[model samples]
Target: MPQTSQGSQAGEGADPAPAGRPPEHPPRWSWWLVGIVIPLVGIAVTVLTVPSQSPNRPPAPPASSSPATTRPPASPPPLPVGLFRLTNADSLMCLSPPPGNSTPAAGLVQGDCDARPEQFWRLRREETGTGVVYSVRNQHTGLCLSVDAAHKENDVTVTQYLCGDENGLFPDQFWSFRYDTLRHAWRLVSRNSGKCVALPAGSGDGEQALQEDCDGGTWTLWRT
Candidate 1:
């Protein structure tokens, strides 16, 4: 009978264990407090650690002031001054007035290549366009090649006249050059009459220069 009572006592202890599993106490207040306080502390820390802008700070410099901004260098001017000889392509002669004749009416003539001061011409740029106008000045007499009375007539003669003469400025003094690709030569065209400098038919030494319509003929071809 005592063994049966001890077995009943053990069964009763086992039943209390199942009742104990329901809950020993309600949820801890410390855990609830920790959950609420931890989030509040995190929000407070985030607010305190964030950076703020100051209204008194100066503005940054412009992008153009940066090292990447640079300007290109300027280009050089073209040189149009030089010494040359105006040679007739057909006659194979140089244009030179008689060295002693420095008068306004002294006509220019085709002469043998002597490389004299009378044949040495200084070309100076007068204007720029599709073609550039140059004043052909003689190194010997300091005269300029000009048309007779600035005439626009065909077969007119070319002469060496005083540069900037009191007779007044004339376009006849300005000569332009056109390149002849076919002949590989240049045509000396007068600015006033628009005529090409030419050697007369059967030209010889001391023959005067003539103005004719440009036809790319060997007589109209000139070289510097």
Candidate 2:
């Protein structure tokens, strides 16, 4: 039997999709490509946004650097205790009691440099408000060098006496050393008079040592 013309046209016009269902989706590979491309774009953006340190940049210094330490200078040694001969610079003589006189209150004088007990003096130290002073003690008579209180003149005679005061009330027995750089020696300065032990001009043997103005000259300088 030959089909009708209307039936043939209806059969040829059948629906490509089902009546109540959605159309077929795209290929799975296309979805995978979209997912990969989106993540790659996000990673590129993150890398560009963050900052990076330069390869040649120097490292930062410490927050608080410690300062360098320095050391103080050393102090000089103290003078030693011993018996010594005091020689006058001007007259070039040794200081001792008057020749043939070893008694107390005998004046000190310049004499020939010899190995006499009268010429040897034991230097004893005494700390005072002024400074470190010395008591010039005669080894022979066991007396201390002192200034004559009776003489108030510029040039006062220096004598030897007992080595004690009631309470250091008298400073005549205390003497300090003043350094003379030019002469390279020490000047014997009296603590009581603030004067210097010196020899007179054109001093000769047997000349007495007196307290005079501190001229800082060869006359006032003495060597130990």
Candidate 3:
């Protein structure tokens, strides 16, 4: 009791720490949690601030182009050959050579429309100019309408002659038929004289056919 020093009395007043250990400090994980939690909160704030797109919007349409072009049709060609009856609009009389005189130099006259061989003609298109010229031959005589020796004179009687001369030297033999749109009839024009085939006024059976200025009258109008 006399020797129990002051050092022993001081140790008993304060508790002693455990062996091989340091004094406790605040945990370092709190700072690490603060760093991780700050980034997570920032990401959540960014996600909530942005706007969302609508799902019901329609898509855009494509561009357009121009239209195409077009054209028209052509006209029909004429017939090459055919059998026909030559008649006038006035009397409807058939053209024929005087009975029993179907030879060359015989004159064409108006007769009954009786389907006789003399009344039937074989019309063949001449391969010459414009394909409008034709050789009008008698079925019975095998001759064609001719202008005496290819004469170009007026009032010259039209007669029958042999066919097969395509030289055009005798344009008298070639005849051109033109459709008169106004008159609604056919006009027989001579290739040589350029005059029209006409049935003279006061003409009857056995009368010779002649040429005259085109008048588009029934006398100059013919039917095939």
Q: What is the C-alpha RMSD of each candidate to the true structure, in Å?
A: 12.1, 11.2, 14.1
> Against the true structure, whose TM-score is highest?
2
- For model 3, residues 92-208, the per-residue Cα lDDT tens digits are 788888776878877788887896788888887778755668888888898898877777777878788877456443668888887765555678888878888788865776667
Which of the predicted structures, 2 or 3, would earn the higher lDDT when compared with the native?
2
Q: How well is each residue in 39-149 modelled by candidate 2, as lDDT tens digits?
A: 999999999998986789778887876777886544333443788888888778998998668787788999889988889888887877677888888888888888887
**Prediction 1 TM-score vs. true:** 0.60
Which candidate, 1 or 2, has the higher TM-score?
2
Cα miss at 67, model 1 (Å)?
A: 50
TM-score of each: 0.60, 0.61, 0.60
Score candidate 3 by TM-score against the native. Answer: 0.60
The lDDT of model 1 is 0.80
Q: Evaluate residue 176 in candidate 3 and report its C-alpha lDDT on the 0 to 100 scale.
A: 84
Number of clashing residue pairs in every model? 0, 0, 0
Q: Compose the digit string of candidate 1's lDDT tens values, residues 56-148.
A: 967887678547756664433332367778888898899988766777769899889885878888887875464667888888888888888
Go through the candidates in order and give each one's C-alpha lDDT: 0.80, 0.81, 0.78
